[model samples]
Target: MKNQLEITLQNRKNLHAILEQTPNEDLLKIPQGFRNNIWWNIAHVVVTQQILVYKLSGLQMRVPEALVDKFKKGTVPDGTATDAEMKMVADFLLSTITWTKEDYEAGLFKNFNEYTTSAKVTLRNVQDAADFNLFHEGIHLGSIFAIRKML
Candidate 1:
């Protein structure tokens, strides 16, 4: 069994490969409801990594403030992202994952608060949070894949 951090890192790598194969124009189409495109999903994962890991661990989010509202959680895609902006976000996300992996492996977030929502599982530590975040990534990845198939 792989550790939580390893699993999370693997998932991030997989997502990056998926995005690399996905074209820029495919990132703006909405296949379903108010859900954003692949670009939004990718950005959300990166942003949430900063929020849930760095912030919870008493570290600052390295991402710029100007990009926060555009990629923050609950900010749906309105077909507003340009090719350059999408590339920027993608590069930032990849770099953030590289930085976050070391922190996670160091066990710096061992004492953070545990959150138990109405969801199917309970996260009690950084391990749980890492695992759950990977699951969250899967949800968004699936959504993106479905949307891409539709388009």
Candidate 2:
């Protein structure tokens, strides 16, 4: 099996492609407020990865605090994002994934915190964390796709 970082990188790439296929206007429409829009979901994934990799693993995360609230979990866009801002966040997410892979290979992750879920145990190391994150990303991706179909 590929390492956790590789799997996560692949998932990120796949998600980027999926997002690109979504029309820009469709990215902002949330169906019934049950789920966030495509853009919000994408941003959430980026924020989540940064939080887990940087805060949880003690790696560097350059994302600004001001921007963190904008993309942090449960923060939906109130139609406040300019086109430029949306694009910038998307670009930054892609870059962050690349940087994370480099750091992973360099052994920057030292923590091996076990992650438990009600369903099952998820991770036992950085590699495991990466795998779990990739799985989580898929869940987000599914939500995005389902929301797109609804909208």
lDDT of 1: 0.70
lDDT of each: 0.70, 0.72
Pairs with steric clashes in candidate 2: none
TM-score against truth, every candidate: 0.79, 0.80
| lDDT per residue (tens digit) for residues 39-139 in model 1 | 78887887776766666556767787667777777677778677777677768756776677766566665566656634667766666666777778778
Each model's total of backbone clashes: 0, 0
Candidate 2, backbone clash total: 0
The candidate that wins on TM-score is: 2
lDDT of 2 by residue, 17-131 (tens): 8667777788778788565778887877888777656766665565766667787865767755677777767676678778887776777888755656444856667665666
Residue pairs in candidate 1 whose N, alpha carbon or C atoms collide under 3 angstroms: none
Best by lDDT: 2
The TM-score between candidate 1 and the true structure equals 0.79
